[model samples]
Target chain A: MERGGVTVRVLGIDPGLTRCGIGVVEGIVGRPLTLVDVNVLRTSASVPIAQRLVTIERGIDAWLDEYSPDAVAVERVFARSDSSTIMGTAQASGIALVAAARRGLPVATYTPSEVKAAVSGSGRADKAQVGAMVTRILRLDAPPKPADAADALALAVTHVWRGGARARIDAAVAAGRTP
Target chain B: MERGGVTVRVLGIDPGLTRCGIGVVEGIVGRPLTLVDVNVLRTSASVPIAQRLVTIERGIDAWLDEYSPDAVAVERVFARSDSSTIMGTAQASGIALVAAARRGLPVATYTPSEVKAAVSGSGRADKAQVGAMVTRILRLDAPPKPADAADALALAVTHVWRGGARARIDAAVAAGRTP
Candidate 1:
């Protein structure tokens, strides 16, 4: 099998201000597998408020450097109450996109429902169910810790499952021309 | 002391698209002091663009809720070469400011040069020097990691040193109560 064509490594991340959960997985084409590493990363705010974002910036760089996955997958914000929250989330998300795109990697996004569905066979599965299914699907001894890690893995799973289907459909629609 | 004497805990954030450095400081009588705690946060494009921001939003909320910082100090973006980069930075900074202000916390801003001067003897001091000085002034264990963290600390230091001064001057001017 061709190197690039056969195997793909993916990084999945869950974004939050204080903590961002990250998971990395390897996928083989035509195989319902690919599970690798996972971790829960944190950022603190005890310093002056002005520097918190800078703290975040450094962390992302380290994450990228550490994993260097083939593709990046992240969850999309489903809903938020506060306008301020939505705005902040938007900014952080932009940085994530910038980082991935800069590396010339294919980046994909999955919604909460989509990730849950992929992992748990239910779009509205609760966090615990998703975590359990993640363990089952990946054949792990237990679900990843702190919940966020499991969520990140589910996002990676969703991307691996859906990304291929979308690519093929887009190719078919374009009749071999770039979209 | 009057209840409305205006004690603002301004969380100053320096926005870097990749790093998204943040600093949280409390402003009393418009004078801020850097709190001891600080660190790097990370996110990746493999997540949905919106999710990354959500992470940031949550981080800010946790800080605000925990410290009850009265206002936020944000470093304004000077023009950048790339339109997309500037646009994203502006968007992110805008979001950070809004998140604080929307919660009835006033927001303030400072420029990069201004932050440098406030932290270091010279506005053009190199990053290492700035980092060294930041550690010295704040009594930090080491220079904040990943240039962005240093930058974030710089933003906080600037806001504490200069943002407070600006706010007081602005308040006096607005009230026609100059000393």
Candidate 2:
């Protein structure tokens, strides 16, 4: 596929304590997005919280160094009834944000609904629907294994479709032009 | 007063996004504790979450480098009705943990009640009582400023009192002697 125009690469993170999904996608709006990479970083629950956080940080730092994405996207954490799970997710998300920010890369967070709406055209889309749409959009052989991995890819595609537009508007406003 | 026997240096962090409290205390169990340092690291709420986290990481790294404490202590975060506040705190605490872990320092988390009990003889002690006890324990003329700073000192004192005893037991067990 002959690509033209500016390609914005984004690294997306689905943050979790045990299994953090990471994916990178490259493309601009209205174009076929290319999958750069996808993987999940896991930390042992038996380890201390501090050690687990360190492992997550190292994994994120390595991804940032390898891909050198223009921007990083992370799933925004919400308070859930399960306090322990939510706390772990929030902590993992923090590591991702700090890793990207330290590299001076722009970082953005999308709520689950926002990501789903962007990828599947409906905020209320189920997991299977989102997975199916992601596979179709990226032209993948199959949906990324492990829901976390697919969710991460969906987040990247969402950023490319949404954040790219927002960035342009921001650039225009900065240039003293109405976006 | 001249200090005697293995003094353990501990840095305690009361993590918050807006104002993170950091304090260092050095002492052995059953001895006068010394306040080495105390301060609060503030990040503007108007800043992006990623930027705030980066600011916190830098502040923590600086403290770790300067104090070189034997261990790091952080306050355990609990879920509250105010989701936003708890989320920010969880994130900040994560940053503190990773900062210490990255330096290969041992990290421990003490609950609020544990800290209160360690300092004030009652698990339900109020903030004022904890502050008064900390001031008296460290033999300081006044309580640390900004409540957060005082709370941080309290956490360090709690860890020094508790962790020191636990360490001795662990060491003795490692030496094949019943603690």
Q: Where in model 2 is the C-alpha error above 4 Å?
A: A1-4, A168-179, B1-4, B167-179
Supply candidate 1's per-residue lDDT for B11: 63
| lDDT tens digits by residue: candidate 1, B44-147 | 75553445555665676676787676556677764432444554465457457646754756567777767777788787888888788777766678887877
Cα RMSDs of all predictions? 14.9, 3.0
Candidate 2's DockQ: 0.79
DockQ of each: 0.09, 0.79
Residue A122 of model 1 has an lDDT of 87
lDDT minimum window of 10 residues, candidate 1 chain B: B25-34
lDDT digits (tens) for residues A121-164 of candidate 1: 88999999999988887889888888988988888777777776
**lDDT by residue for model 2 (A7-80), tens:** 89999999999999999999888889999999999999867788899999999899888998999889998887
